[model samples]
Target: MQPEGQAKRLVIVSDAWHPQVNGVVRTLTKLREQMEARGFEVTIISPADYRSAPCPTYPEIRLALTHPLAIRARIEALQPAYVHIATEGPLGIMARRACLKNNWRFTTSFHTRFPEYLRERLPVPLSWSYSFLRRFHNAAEHCLVPTQSIHDELAERGFATLKVWTRGVDRELFRPQPDVDLKLPRPVFLCVGRVAPEKNLESFLSLDLPGTKLIVGDGPDLHELRRKYPNTVFAGKKEGETLARYYAGSDVFVFPSRTDTFGLVLLEAIACGLPVAGYPVPGPKDVVGASGAGVLSDNLQKAALGALEMGRVDPDVRLKGFSWEACADIFESVLTTIGSAKVLKSRKVKSDRVIPAP
Candidate 1:
C-alpha cells in the first residue's frame, strides 16, 4: 500500500494507447496529463507493457495477450486508489476480471461504437454485439459516455449508472490561421480521422462536390481507399501544429462517420474556425447543435456546400464549455466518488453536473 501523503494513485487500464493516433488514445493521454497536474499519480497499463498481437483487420492497434493473473498481480503491486477501464479489448477484459475477482469497484468509459463497427466489417448482429458490450460496461460502478445521444441510446439498451464525460480540445494548437493556405482548390472539404470502414470515408470521397476532398489520417483502408479514389488527396497521419493547420487551412470540415460516439475532429475543426458538414447523426448533432458553427444534412454534398458559404467565425463563441481543465475535473470527480466518497465531497467544485440514468 502507498504510504500517506503520496499523491492519490490512479490506474488506467486501456487497450488503446500510443503509438496509435485516434480519439481514445488522445482523450486518455490528455486525461492522464490533467489528472497528474491535479496531484494524482497516474499509471497507464497498455499493450506496450505486455506481449501483444496486432488486431485483425486493424493492424495499427495491438491486442494484449496477457493472463488475468498477471493483470491482477500488476494491479496489486501498483496499489491504485482507483481503476478505470477505458476499453473493452483483451487488456480491458482481463483488468475487469481482475478487479471483479478481487471485489474491487472500477469505472468504465464507452469510447467506441464497436457494435456498429463490427457490423460494418463482419456479419455480426448488432443485438449480439450490444448484448456483450452492455454486459461488459454494466459490470462497472458507472459507465461514462461522451454525449447525451449515446447516453440515451445506451440507457434504452439497459445500461445503468450512466454519466456524461464530454471531451475537450487543445485550443492553443488548433486555432485559426487566417493567412494559412493548403493551396488546394477553392473550397477544400477536409475530413480528419481514421480511414476505416466504420468511418464511412467513402461517403465523403464519393460525393460530387466542388474543390478537393482531403483525408488527414491513416487506417487499415488507406491503401484500398487511395487506390479507389485516386482524385482525393490523402495527407496520411499528421500531428501537432501540422494536423491543426490542416483544419485551419480547410474551407469546410466534412465528417461522414455515423458510428463515432463523439468526433473529436468536429471540436478540432470548429476550434480552427472551420465550418463543419456532416450527417445529422449523433456526433454532429451533439457538437454542432444550434451552435451555427456547422451545417448538418442527410445530403452530404448539400451540407458541404452550405458550410462553405458560412465562412470562418470566432470559435470562442461556439466552444464556450469545452476545455481540458473541465474535462479532468469531471473525470476526477467520478473516480474520487467511486474510490472514496469523502474525497469527492471535499474537492473544489469545478462542475456539479452529473447525468443520472433516466
Candidate 2:
C-alpha cells in the first residue's frame, strides 16, 4: 500500500517513442495513459527527449546517442518507485547499467525477437545474439514477454524470470465502420505493417489471391517492394481515424511476420470487424486462438481467400478479452510487486561503483 495522495512513481526507459509509429510505441503510449488513470505517476525517458541518430537501414527509428551518465542522472533524479526498461537499444542498455550501479531492481520487456531480426540483416549467428540478450535481460527482476508462446520459446533459449505481459487495442477507435468507402475491389486483403524483409511482405505480395492487395504502412523496403509488386496499393502510414477506416474497409488483415512477439495490429484488425489471415505463427496463434476472427494456415494465399468469405464477428464479443485497462492492471501489479512491501526498502549501495556525471 502507498501513502495517501502520494502517487507511486513509475519510470519507463524505452528506445522507441513518438515520430516512430510502431507497435511498441502504441503499446507504451496506451499503457502510460491507463496507468496514470489508475493513480500511478508515469515518467517516460525515450529518444524523443535526447540527442538521437537515425538507426541503420531502418532510418525511421531514431537511436538515442546520449551518454550512460546522462541517463543515470535522469533516473536518479526521478527516484521512481519502479523502473522498467522497455527495449534492447542504447537507452535500455544505459538504464540497465544505471540500475546495476545503484543496486536497483528493475524489470525489462522483450518486445522484439532481436536474434531473428539480426540474422535477417547481419551475418551473426542467432546463438550469439540470444546469448547477449539473455545476459541483458537476466539482470532484471522480471523479463516481461507479450505471449505465452514467446515466453516458452525464450525459456527454451535460456531466458529467466519470464512473465506474460499481453497487449490491448483501443476498441472505440478501431471498431468497424461498414460505411467507409475504400473504392477498391471487393474482398480486399490488407497488410498493415512496416514494408521490410523481416515482415515477409514478399510472401503476401507474391500471393495469387483475388481482389486488390493493399499495404497501409511504409518502411525501408517500400520503394523496392512497390517496384516489384506494382499491382499492390501502398497507402503509406496512417493513424487514428484514417488507420481505423482502412482496417474497416479491408475484408481481411494479412500479417506475414513470423518473428513478431505479438501482433498488436491483429487486435486492431479484429476490433475493426475484419478477420485475419496469417501463418500459424506465435503472434497470430496466440491472438486468434480459435476465436473465429482469423484463418491461420501455412498457405497464406489460401488463408486470404478463406478469410474473404468468413463472416465478421461482432467486434465487442470478439475483442472483449483485450483492453488497455486490463493490460495496465497487469503492468501495475508488476510495479507493485517490485516497488511495494516486497523490496521497497533502500539497500546499501557499493560507493565504489558510482555512476559519473556526464
Candidate 3:
C-alpha cells in the first residue's frame, strides 16, 4: 500500500529529556526534528515529563516514572531497528539491556563526560572511574562524540568505536540583527544552563566584574546562588526564540565547565554575534580556537578582562561550516554502516568475539 522503500524507525533513550535543560536534550531534539522531516519516525524514552514545554516548578527535577522497566517493555514492543542511548541512567540501562537481549545493534552518544561530572559532586577521582564509563559506552556499536580531540582521548582510553558528531548553531535564529535589545539596568552578562554545582557559575559571579551578572536558567542551586549574589539577575527558563534573544542581547557568555564535552551555547553566542569569555576548558578551547570569537582563562581576573575584550570577536568565523543538516547526514551514514554485518565484524577484536571494552 505504501512506497517500495521507507525510512527506518529510530528510538532515542535518555534520562534527561524534555523537562531537563541540557546538551543531550538539545542535540537529540535537533536530530529528531531533522530525521522526522525526511520521513523517519522517531520516539524518545525518557524520565522527564512531556505534559508541557518544560517541567513545572521553576527549574524542577522530576524524578523518573515509577518502574522504568514497564516503559522499557513498551519500547521493546515497538521494535525499533536503530536505537541511540543518549544518556546513561536507569532508562538507558534498560534500553541497552533491551538491545543486548535482542542482539539489536545500537549507538551511544558522548553527551556528557559523566566521570568528570561525577567528580564535581562526589569526592571521586575521575581518572579511576573513566574506564568503567568507557566500557558502558563501548557496549554499543558506535559512540558519537563532538570533537576529534575527545574522540582521540576516548580511543586512547579504550573506547574503540568512537565517531565525531559535532554540534551545529541555529544560525538563522541566533544571527546578530544589531537592532533588538533587552535594555538591562547596566550591562547583563549571562551564563545560561542548569544552575548546578558542576557548571561552576560561582566563578563568574566571584569575578568582581562590572555590570549585572545574569543567570538565565533555573536549577537546584538557584536559591543558594541568589542568596549569595543578591545583585545578580535570575531570568528563569526561556525557550525557542526567547532563548536565542537572550543569547543575542547578552554582553558576553561565561562558560566554566572544564568537563563539558562540548558547549553548544558557545556556538549559539557566536551565531548571535556575541563574543564569549570563559574557562580554557575543552568546549571553550576548541570553539574559541575555531572562531577566534572569545578568550579563555582559568584565573577570574584574566577571564573578567577577556569578557571586556568580547567585542573584538569574529562571530562569522564560528558560524562558517556548522550545520545541523550536515551533522544529521553524517549520523545517517554511520547509522547505515552500523546496521551492516561487515562493519560489525571488522570492528571485532579478531579474538573471534566482541572486544573487551575499557
What stretches of model 3 exceed 4 Å from their correct place? 1-7, 48-59, 62-73, 185-187, 310-314, 336-358
lDDT of 1 by residue, 194-309 (tens): 88888998999999988899999988899999999999999999999999999888999999999899889999999999999999988799988746788899998899989989
Each model's C-alpha lDDT?
A: 0.87, 0.85, 0.73
- Measured against the true structure, the TM-scores of the candidates, in listed sequence, are 0.92, 0.93, 0.84
Instruction: Please give the TM-score that candidate 3 achieves against the real structure.
Output: 0.84
Shift in Å, residue 48, candidate 2: 1.4
Tens-digit per-residue lDDT, 59-128, candidate 2: 9799998889999989888767679999999999999998888778889999998888889999999999
Better of 1 and 3 by lDDT: 1
Number of the top TM-score candidate: 2
User: In candidate 1, how many Å is residue 105 off?
Assistant: 0.9
lDDT of 1 at 265: 91
Candidate 2: C-alpha RMSD to true structure equals 4.7
**lDDT (10s digit) by residue, model 3, range 18-92:** 656777778888999998997777888777532323223333544454454665576666645568888776677
Error of 3 at 165 (Å): 0.5
Clash pairs (backbone) in predicted model 3: none
Q: After superposition, how far is residue 65 of candidate 2 from its true place, in Å?
A: 1.3
Global Cα lDDT for candidate 3: 0.73
